[model samples]
Structure formats: structure tokens, C-alpha cells
Target: MTVILLRHGVSTSNVAHTLAGRSAGIDLTDRGREQAQALVQRLGSLPIEHIVCSPLLRCQRTVAPLADKLGIDVEPDERLLEVDYGDWTGRPLGELISEPLWKVVQRHASAAVFPGGEGLAQVQFRVVSALREHDAALARKHGGEVLWVACTHGDIIKSVIADAYGMHLDLFQRIVVEPASISVVRYTPTAPFVWRVNDTGSDLSTLAPPRDPAARSGPVPGGETGNTVSTDNEGVEHPDSHTE
Candidate 1:
């Protein structure tokens, strides 16, 4: 199963350089709306079977265009919500940087907990758990390779990517998930493959499943001479193949 993590478009809080956290009413900027609409063209043709997003208005707005285009309902998942900045909610980033805890958040995020919010490690756990649950459910329902989207915040996307790479939560800051970008992860029974990260623009047609079922097989040991898609026992595609 393939899960595409999409960060919400630029928000008013983003323009103000503030942490919106779980606050209500933060919306996308005009340019953000344009970015949201562009997703219709970027992902509309893909074989996306389901769409899930953060309950926040920003994420909801981001995936709205694409969901409408694909005629799919958008399901909001709380686990996909932005990090709970708690007391830091709506505070300026510059101001937050001056605090002592800021250093811990940057260099030792696994142990860094917001004054009244959740820890970065907690954020990673919830989001990753949600993703695995959804992936398993979708794979069973589709009974084969499946593609889906999860529209969320930048930090949330970064955390997921870090987990996919088997990196420590403290190093998640090194992964940049820009506003409205898309990162892809293919989950297999054995491991997860990080196909693309923070991809803002590129052709995505290659993500579609091959037309022939026979084309879905594990990669060649030495190298792949042609396109191949690997499938597991349950019919879920594994990222073991090398496409040329």
C-alpha cells in the first residue's frame, strides 16, 4: 500500500511566522488556495481510493479540491493533526526561539515536551500508528495494491518521513516538508520504502500500478531490465523492484 503525505498549503499563521498549533480558524492564504486548487491537476488522474486529512481547516481546505475532483469524501483523523503547541499556540516562532526549551526541541526532540502540549515523540507515534492502521485497512478492502492520500501539517509529514527512514525523532527536524508538498511511502510487511520526499512538482504518472498483473513481481537480483512491481501474499505491492 502506498500512502502519500501532503502538507497543507501556506496558512495565515505561516505568513505571520507563528505556530497555529491546534487553534481554530487559521486559514490558507490566497496563494495557498491556488496551491490547493493545483492539486486537482497534480493528483486527479492517480488511482487514489481514499482521502484522509487533519481536521484542521487548513488541511481540509488543502485536500478539498482534489477530493472534489476525484469524487471522494474526505475523512478527518485527529491523529493527523498538527503538533499540540499548547501554551505556545499562536506564538511567534522568533519569540519561541528565545526560550530555553527551544534548544531541546531542536537538538533533543525525543525528550522535548511542550510546556502543556505533547512531546515530538508522541506526535510521531500517533501519526505513524494512524498510518499503519489505515494502510492495513485499505489493503484489505482493496485486496491489492492501493494508493491513498493523507493531507496534514508540515511537522506531521516530517515525522512520518523520519519514521519511514527509521530515524530518531530528534532528527526529524532535518527533514523539510514544505507547504503543499507531497511525500510518498510504500508500506510492506517487512519494511516501508520512502519513494519521494518533499516533492512539490514532478510528473506522478509513474506511481500508477502496472496494467499487467504479471508485471507485479519482486525485483531482479542483479538489476532490473524493465519495469517491475512486486506484490506480497495479500496482493499488496512491495517496493522491492527496480524500475529503469
Candidate 2:
């Protein structure tokens, strides 16, 4: 199955430079709505079978244009929700940077837990597991060949990319996911392939309809999971390169 992970467009909090986290009432900005519409234009041609988005309003607003254009309902999944920032939920980024916990968040995030919310590890587990479950379910539903989109938050998207690359949570800081950016990952029985990361372009015509329909069961001879190919975005095991 092919999963397109997208960060929601910029929100009101984004322009204010505040940590939106899971805070309610944060909606997309006018430019954010335009960005979402641009994303729809970029990916409108793909045969997207499913659209899953975080329960957050920002995410819902981000994918709304695409969902409407494609005539597909957006499935709100809490697992795709933004990380709970706890006390830092609505705090300004400039101020949070001075807090002692900020150092840990920037350096040793694996051990950094929010004052009253989740740790990076906990967030990673929840988001990645949710993605894996959805991928497996879609594979089963579409005969192991499917195209779906997951609209979520920056940190959530980064964590999933880190898991795909098999990198330690401590190194997740090196991975950057910008708002409204799109990343693609394909999971097979044997390995996973990273297609695009934080890409604002790429129509993704090369990803749809399964490169080799039969390869969904296992690695194929001249397809995505094949060892013979050495493309940058080809199948890569974890810990080597987190984002291709």
C-alpha cells in the first residue's frame, strides 16, 4: 500500500508563532486555505482510495479542499491528532525556547516528556501504529494495492518518517516536516520504500496503481522492493536514511 503523509497547512497559531499542539479553535489562515487548494491541484490526478485526517480542525481544513474535489469523505482519526503539548499547548515558541525542557526537546527528545502531556516516544508509538494499522487494513481491502492520504501535524509526520527510517527517537530532530508538505511511503511484507519527503511539488504520477500489482505480496523482480534498483527513493531499511 502507498501512504501519502501530509502536514496540515499553516494555521492561525502558525502565523502567531505559537505552539498549537492539540488546542481547539485553531483554524487555517487564508493563505493556509490557498495552500490546501494548491495541494489539491498538485495531487488531484492521483487515484486516491482513502483520505484520513487528524481530528484537529487545522488538519480537517487542510484536507477539506482535496476531499471535496475528489468527492471523498475525510475520515477523522484521533490517532492522527497533533501531540498534546500540555502546559505548552498555546505558548509562544520564542518563550518556550528559553525553558529548560526546550533543550531536552531539541537534543534528547526521546526522554523529554511534556509537563502534563505525552513524551516524544509515546507520540511516535501512537502515530506510527495508527499508520501501520491503516496501511495493513487498506492493503487487505484493495488486494494489497492501494493509495491513501493521511493529513496530520508536523511532529506527527516527522515521527512516522523517523520510524520508517528506523532512526532512534533522539535523532528525530534531524528530520524536518514543514506544514503542507507531502511525503510518500510504501510498505511491503519485506521492506518499506520512502518516495518523497517534505515535497511541495511532484504530481506523484510515479506512485499510483502499484508499480507491480503482484509485488504487494512480497518483493518483486523489477519493482519497488527489488534489490536491483538503487534509486534514492527506493526501498530502504531503517537507521540508514530516515528521509529519502
**lDDT tens digits, residue span 69-185, model 2:** 999999999999888888888887878888999888878879989999889899999988898899999877887588899999888888888888888888887876666778878
Q: Pick the candidate with the highest lDDT.
A: 1
Candidate lDDT (C-alpha), each: 0.81, 0.79
Write down the TM-score of every candidate: 0.88, 0.87
RMSD of each: 8.2, 5.7
Model 2 ranges off by over 4 Å:
213-244
Worst 10 residues of 1 by lDDT: 235-244
- Please state the error at residue 82 of candidate 2 in Å: 0.6
Model 1 bad stretches (over 4 Å): 210-244
lDDT of 2 at 203: 51
